[model samples]
Target: MTQPTPDHHGIIYRRAALDEGYTDKQLTRRVDDATMTRIWSGAYVLNTGETRTPEELHRLTAIAAVTSSPDSGFALSHQSAGVLHGLSLLTPQLDRVHLSTGYATGARLEKRRHLHSGALDDADTVVVDGIRVTSLERTVVDIACSVGFAQALAAFDSALRNGADAAVIAEYLEGHKRGVGQARRALGHADAGAENAGESWGRAQLICAGLPTPRLQHEFYDDAGVFIARTDYDWLGKLAAEFDGMAKYQRHLADGETAFDAMRREKEREDALRRLGVMVIRWVWEDLRRNRVVPMVREWLDRLGIAA
Candidate 1:
């Protein structure tokens, strides 16, 4: 077998492989031997034995779906385009590749591909990493209309942080009847201050539970005005909440600093906030998964005599 070559994006399509003088049998044998991964019907990516995140795998699959199709019928949309645009989706549908088509009249799902029919103008499409996809604002509005509130809020928050115009997103939602109510509400509360998907998700949970929306990325200073820390969620200058995802700690690690070292620094920062008479609450990913954030926060508020 000759050594196969993939394109710059590390994707090799069947037709391209055949045109390059590779036999169909060779491609089949490679897939059977686990040397190449069949991302879609005729698209392949070399297997390097490294596990890919769900987002990465879905991205490759979406690329394959678009490239392998016989015609230019659709562009990646919804959570598919969201991932490509670097938007964070709390609970994305990873198993299916979503494509938007202006020619089709409705939605269809088959063989792990979702075909959505909609009016996609020139303004609603963009090319990301060599693949056609819905623009950032369109992707956010699409996801907002198609999924749950928490997931929509996460995407909205991420889009805002990525410099997507809120007015443009609102314009996309204007007079759109599908999920405009919740999408509009999500946009109304979306904040660019959210540092990541986890913080956005935690805030969404609180809001869905009828809690007051907390101020995001609130900073604390010492008596002499020296900066102490910026919290994930701050309420009334009396309480602060931090989402304890491993990524959060990893992001703060300096050169030669272990995660433990970063954690120690975080503890000291929290201690400083405590000294300022602010109550600090921290929750991990498991808490969010188990739906304990609302009750836990409510309990803390009641115990601290803070008005909910």
Candidate 2:
């Protein structure tokens, strides 16, 4: 078969060889430009102006393409599905593609692909752009079962905020009889106001320590009736607690700036809030995981004449 000329987007491996058989040597010789870039091992691009690949879409497409037999089917699983469904507040660190199927099938993938075996019901699954994916509720349950508690809570929060019904998820869990316990527990602890995983974990820690639950994503208004600032958590009356996630602050640091400019900005924000009669207590990742934060929080509450 004769090789087709490269299109405007350049030649992709699947398109170049799948349509008409083209030997590897012939395809390689066609692209004499050294500027041609290799995305994965086989995927290549000749034009630099070509649009970059969307990672989520690429993952989904790979899963669909790999399932060649009737017994071979895949569902987007875990955090990967969460990202595709827009239930993830933060980007996933791991790039592995997750797939579920009843039959074992293998393919060379650009990234690690995890496989799970089970009969997927209609309610637990949905089709997105011709690809089967775990439903929003199922995705949340899978995340709760697989990832850390903090990440689970964040996923739950994003799902809730995006119009996922907690009751529907609960019913799905009950009927499925798989991961029901985890679903129930996660539902009980899920807080939509958690902006990130660290804040969610910090809230859970405080609750476990018997400290009174503070207002989440609480907004503070100045005396002039203007919105001054908002905090992750705020103790009503006098003592105010704020969870300072390390991830939150590190996101603001410059590439190599050694000066404490970020610290100075935080101090300013705190002082402004304090001027409005709100006592600010900051908690970081280490403090949240340890027992010290509990007592420190309680002490601040007691000093402010607020019962803890």
lDDT per residue (tens digit) for residues 168-273 in model 1: 9999898588888998888888998987778888898899888878999898999999999898888887889998844687887898999898878888988999
Please report, as a residue range, the 10-residue window in candidate 1 with the lowest summed lDDT. 244-253
lDDT of each: 0.87, 0.65
How many Å off is the CA of 255 in candidate 1?
2.7
For model 2 the local lDDT of residue 274 reads 85
Which residue pairs clash in candidate 2? none
lDDT, candidate 2, 51-76, per-residue tens = 64455444433443333324445677
Give the root-mean-square deviation of each candidate in angstroms.
Answer: 1.9, 6.5
Q: 47 in model 2: Cα distance from truth in Å?
A: 13
